[model samples]
Target: MSLESFGEQLRRAREAKQMSLGEVADATRISLKFLQAIEAGKFSILPQAYIRAFIREYARAVDLDPEKTIQQYDMANQEIRATAEEWVSRSRNAALRQTKERTREIASLPVFSQRSVTIFAVLVVAAVAVVYLLNVGSDSSQQDDVSEIAFDKVIRESEAATVRTESGRALPTFEARDDSLRLEITTIDSVWLAITIDNTRRGEYLFAPQRKRTWVGKEQFQISIGNAGAASFKLNGVELGMLGNRGVVARNVLITRSGVQKTQQ
Candidate 1:
C-alpha cells in the first residue's frame, strides 16, 4: 500500500475505535493540532521523531497492533528511505574521496626550508599574542564606562511553539545572550504587558500602541510578554520560553545558585 493510503487506514482505524483527536493528544502529550494532522494523513507536517511516536501512540490508543502498523508504515516508505540513504552514502563517499585527493595534492607541494618554517612559526605566534592582548585591553577599557554588557540575539525557547518578533511576524529562530539580555517591545494597539521571570508570571500593565519598549539587563532570567506583541528567547540551542496572545504570561528563566537580579519594562 502507498504511504498515504497507510496513513488513511490508520486514521480510519482510529476513528472506528471512537477515539477523539484530543484524547490521543492528551495521552501522548502531543499537541491536538498535530494529532489532527496525523489523522488527516498530513504526515509530512510532523517532525521525524514525532511521526513514529505519534504512530505508536495512535496504535496503542486504538488497541491496534503497534508492530503491525509500524511494519506497514515501514513497508510503505521503504523505497523513499532506501533512496535517501543511498544518496547520503554516495555523498559521504564522494566527500571522503575528495578529501584524500586534496591531501595528496598538498603533500606533493614543494617543502619550505627549515629556516623559513621557523620564521613563519614565530610570526604566527606573535600575531596570535597581539590579537589576545587587543581583545583583553578593549574589554578592560570598556568596563569602567559600560553600564551593562549589551548585545541583541534572537530568542528561540520552544520547539513546538512559535515566537513573534516586534514586527508582528513569526520568528523561525532566536538567540541567547551569555553576558546580558535585551527585551524589545512594540504594540499594534494599546494593551496590557505581562511578563514572567524564570517561568514565574510577573506584573502586567497597560501599554499604548505604536510605542516601543526596551529593557536592558545583566540578569540570568529574562522574558517579556504582552497581548499585542510577540516574545521569545533562547539560551544556546535550548528555547527559554514562548509568549502568546491571551492568558497570563509564563516564561522560563535559568538562575544560578546565588540568584540573579531582574528588571522589567
Candidate 2:
C-alpha cells in the first residue's frame, strides 16, 4: 500500500485515536475551521505564514510525531519548489537577454561628434572664467568697504576711550600704584550705578536720594553711573567734585590710590 500524505496520515491517526475534529479543536483551542483545513491539506485556506504551527498543534492533539509529520509535509512540497525554481530561472534569463539587446541598441545610437564635444568644452571653460572674474571683483569691493568700516570703528573706539568733560577742563591722571584705594560716592539724587574693584564686580546699585556708598580696593576701582550729576565722589576722603552732568550716563571713571583720573571718551 502507498504511504499516506501528510493530511491523510493526520486524519488516519486521529481516527485511530477516536478523536473528532471538534474534540481536537476544543482541546487545542484552535478554530474548528482551521483544524479542518489543516487535515484537508488546504494550508492556503489557513494563514500560510502560520501553517506550520497549525499542523504542529493538530499533530500533537492526535498523538502523532509533529516533527516527523512536518518533515513529510516539506518532502511533499519539494516538487513544487523545484517547479518554481525552473520558472524563475527561465524568467531571469529572458530579462537578461532583453537588457543586453537594449544596451546594444543604445550604444549603436550616435552621440556627440568630436567638433560638438570641442565646442561644448570651450563654452564650459568660458563660463567658469567669467564666474571667476566676477567673484574676484566682488571680493575687491568687499575688501574696500571692510577697510572703510574698520577705519570708522577705530575712530569711534578712540573717542570712547577719552573721558568727556565740561569745557575741556583738563581731567586729572593718576599713576598706577600697589597701595589701597578707597572711593566714597554720595548720591545727590537717585542714581543707577555699577562699581568694580580690582577687576571684580563689586556691586550695581540704584542709590536712594542722598545715600552714600564707600569701597576700598587694593588695586583699582571703576565706576559707571546712569545720572552723572546725581552723585558726588571723594577719593581718600578728599572731595573730588561733581561726578558728572545731570541725566548724562558716565560709563568710565578710572580710580587709583594716588588720585582720581578721568577715562578717555
Predicted structure with the largest TM-score when compared to the true one: 1
lDDT digits (tens) for residues 69-110 of candidate 1: 878877866654555556555655565565556555555659
Question: Which consecutive 10 residues in model 2 have the weakest lDDT in total?
Answer: 140-149
**RMSD to truth, every model:** 18.2, 36.7
Which runs in model 2 stand beyond 4 Å of their true positions?
1-179
- Candidate 1 local Cα displacement, residue 237, angstroms: 20
> Which ranges of candidate 1 are over 4 A from the true structure?
79-265
Give TM per candidate.
0.33, 0.32
What's the distance in Å from true for residue 11, model 2? 86
Supply candidate 2's per-residue lDDT for 147. Answer: 41
Per lDDT, the best of the predicted structures is 2
Name the TM-score of candidate 2: 0.32
lDDT of each: 0.49, 0.61
